[model samples]
Target: MTLRKRLFWLFAPLLVLALLFAYGLSQSLILSRFDRQDAQLLEGEAVRLQNLLEQNLRRNLDLVQSYAQWDTSYEFMHGQHPDYLRRNADPEALSEMNFDFMVFLDLQGRVHAEQWLPPTLTDMFVLDGQPPRSLEALRRAILEQARGLIQTSDEDLYGALIAVQGVPLNLAMGSIQDNQSTLPSAGTLIAGHFLDGERSENLQQQINGTLRLLAADHSVERWAPLPSPGVFSLNRAELSQRHLPNEEQQQILLRFSNSLGQPQMLFELTRDRRLYHEGRKAIAIFLAQATGVSLLALLLIYLGLEFAILRRVSRMHQDIAAIGPDSSQQRLQDRGTDELGRLACEVNRMLERLEQSETRDREILDAIQDGYFEIAPDGQVQAVNRALCNLLDYPAEAMLGQSYERLLSREDAERARQDFALALANNEQIRFSAPLRRGDGSLGHYETRFSLIRDSQGHFAGFRGILRDISEQVAYQNQLLDLAYRDSLTGLGNRKAFSEQLRHALDKAQREQGRLALLYLDLDRFKEVNDRYGHDVGDALLQDIAERLRRTVRQPDRVYRLGGDEFTLVLPDSNSVAAQKLAERLLAELQNAAQIGALSIDFVTPSIGIALYPDHAQNPEALIKAADSAMYEAKRERNRVDLFHPRLLSSSTQSG
Candidate 1:
């Protein structure tokens, strides 16, 4: 991208992010405001519910106290009570008291008699062989629960809502003492009220929240397991408002306990999330305003950049594009002293310096002894120095405009293409040895270095390279290798090559899970011949022996002369049986070997020692030593072959 476009993206996102930050802050403030308002509304509802329930509990407890102190309540209790179900009876006072149920306890705190104010005012019927819970069993349960739950005590009066048979009921318990403060308590009385009654419903309507009463039974399971029930325990914190599964509703829970302080029920209060919706609408308005301001800001940024930098840079680009390296008279025009103006002035100075640098680079490229060339983007050789032309034995006119591939051998051409592409991708230079076809169609090895060139915009322009002829260097290296590993006289590998080849053969046998035989031979009576005759006969005889052995072994085998008359043969894929047979052939080959220029030399027979891989030794040194030991035994006995064995190593050691 142009500098102008890059600057625009760089500054444009910053302005947009600034606008986004403003919007984020606004949203945070609005959410905090909504939280405070919701807190106030939920606290108001909780306060109202608490006041109403507390007021009713106090008044009901007072009424229960008045009832428990009556002399009539004492007469009604403290007796072996007959079954109330034995006769149809009406407790008229129960109706007058307007309580749900009442219980009378004896001095021992045992249930003596009870009265219930069921909605129907009668417990005269049975269904499915069962008494109605609201009449018979419910009244009995209330009175039985009043028995100190352990022992009799002079406890004070108490009232709370309790769940009986999954129904929430209000209960108040007081002592049956005299109206005056002088008398001891005679018995206890527990009065009750239905929490889900008309009066409670009217109280619920006083707050603008929906109310639900959950009895402390399986009915309370939908709530979470309590680490601590917040309000009733020590925390006593305001109940956190619950967001209902429905997105638009929220809830607050108020808990109540029974007379003994056991958890009894929950009053779940829910309200529509009016502030939540209003806050979302307010955020929408904020985002809309922010978008407009951000757009205006972005436009101003874009306009300022266009006027200040982009137009000038565009003109500079056009002017630079129109001028070529040959146009030495052309130069850029300066506008002012701003950054772009200074940048243009610097660019004009750069063009002037580049013209001078180009001349100097051209001179350096031409003056260097190494051949130099430049390839255009189209893979055509655009320019070649006189050195390259002379090195290739071709004129400049014959080489220019030709694709570089034509000058290279097929394999090296493909390799050069890959290296060229790598150089361009990595923005680095590469050097490799490649074979180039000379003008005579003969191939000469050359080391090439390739470097990529890019234009002002960093687009690929072409490739430039230097080539050095390495034919003489490569030939000298080969000669050195030959002198190091070859025996000049015998025309076979020397001791160094034999060691290397033996190790290689062992590795091949091991890899293929095959075997090979190593043969160590000594020309018997040969040193005596060297003593009598000249060294020339001895050397000539050894060369002849090497040739005979080469023809005797298989093609995969290799032969080496370890100086004098000592020779070694590597026979791969050969077992013991194969080794013995080859040794026999070698002995027979030397039997008629006296044809050294009419000298009957048959007396020079070989003492061959054969060692098999794995059966005798695994590595090259051990195998060779084993074979050499066996060869000495053969030499001691003359003109016979011996196979290497463990005992031969020991015997050779003893003789030494």
Candidate 2:
């Protein structure tokens, strides 16, 4: 081949390859953009679903609370004849509300009067023989603890409801006035209600109407009754067997509580996403068409220029041979009326475009602060900006062609892999936080956003994402949370933390049918100590006492300084015997003398009051109050331990 022909051949393949490369790059970019949009849409849908669920739950709770306050319901539960009341009122009005069953229980947790909507002739009684297996153990335990309005349910009672049970104040007060009795009165039944199919259907209709109004512009493909407890799969089985999975299928689970204060309603929502899918497909097609047209134009230009300028310019290159390094600006002059002159003009234009593109790319990369990296399908770092290298404390040359995972800490690499796998499998974006290792062997916390890179065919290729250093922000937030929940003086849990811990301990104890101990400790001469010594010395002494109490207690025990010299110790799995031992140890710890400067000061022993779970009180507040009263009694007796007595609650109320 001649030199001119050889030049044409050499440039021809380069021109074709460039066209093909540009086409592939455009295709990849389009796919990535579509995937990101899809992920955002899914996240938005999930948030909407969560909000809807919360609204439904709140509405049901409000409805239940309203029914509990009704006069007729209260009268019926208080032994007034319901038949007489029903005759006086409209039965249809009563039946309008959805209620499966409403049973009034007496103060002692005994069933008295029962009312079932769509009244079943079969009588439902509160079983005294044994607690029903259906009710959650937690609810049963609550009923055993509290004397007033107790709402609970068993497995049989699937719906949510509000139970209002308390002493009939009107009846009890009247009886007390007539009898002139100093004896404490027993509690009486008041009222309660439940939600049934009629009520559920009514609520569902309201919600469906609201949703329809909110989605006015959008078409709702299907809205039907959610499945009840006993129903088999509604189209679920058929969908699972399909060869090509449907992305438009949306499912929602709805649950509501019954009148007996049990969750019952189980519903589902399957909405069609046909419109959403169609819109996305149309967008993809439009993008693909635009890319194809651009590629065709580039290919024509490459073929036209390859034969014209590349062939003729090589033959005339001898005229330009005298060009030295100092004459770098010299251009090749191709003399021809046909294609050579046009090809030379086109080459100069192409060079100008390349220079402009490079400038724009560098500007864009420099504008971003977050580290941006793109990895090839084989896990090699194909490209990385300056920000990425600077963030990882490495040079651009060092990062290019390196495994992207090598820049991350071992834990971060594992987490990144897991997140990438999740995004690919589910076709979603995965966001997570992990420690990124620096060159100095220290870890920096980074919030990473991982998205699966896909080919034009929608096949998994690799991942591309950005990393942000969120270590400072996370640390500040954690510090705020700690300050909010912790005691400033002793570094122990504050009142808020103590209450939460107490509730958790109570829940565990109730579940296990185990006893928990709440000990109220009052320093005998704490005020005198503070007055005699400076506040600083008193504060130091209190801190010392807190440390001693913490050391003396078990790991499971939680001690709280409830302001001043008063402290509360929560002992899980502790009965009266165990509580007494703890009290003795605390008294001994404080009875000894301590030297504060020149004065040898003697500390007063703590007057301890103990309350056992399900024995003294049910709730945390009640338990604390009961323990407080017992502590007062011990203080009255001069440094002793007092077990909670019901009479103390009554006497203390009278004294107040």
Best of the candidates, lDDT? 1
Identify the leading candidate in terms of TM-score: 1
lDDT of 1 by residue, 69-102 (tens): 7655544454422543123124565555557666
TM-score per candidate, chains pooled: 0.52, 0.39
lDDT of each: 0.73, 0.58
Error of 2 at 171 (Å): 99
lDDT of 1 at 519: 87
RMSD of 2: 47.7
Instruction: Report RMSD (Å) for each prediction in the order shown.
Output: 13.5, 47.7
Point out where model 1 deviates above 4 Å. 1-44, 66-117, 121-134, 147-153, 218-243, 259-262, 360-373, 384-656
lDDT of 2 by residue, 1-656 (tens): 76546655766676567656755664566544654455444334433433444444344334433443345445555666558335632344344433233344544666554343332212222212222344334234323422232333211111222221211000000010112223332223222232223433454454421121111112224433332322111111100111112565444433332323333223333444444466567656765675576567656665665565554666456535745434544555664666667766665566557556866886798679988777776778866777877777777788778886886778778876777677778988788787666766677777867677888997777777887889898889879987988778986778888889999999999899888999999988878877888788888777777888888888623888777788888989888998999899888877777556666668567899999888999999899999999999999876788999999889889999
Worst 10 residues of 1 by lDDT: 229-238
Deviation in angstroms for 619 in model 2? 1.8
Residue pairs of candidate 1 with colliding backbone atoms: 594-601
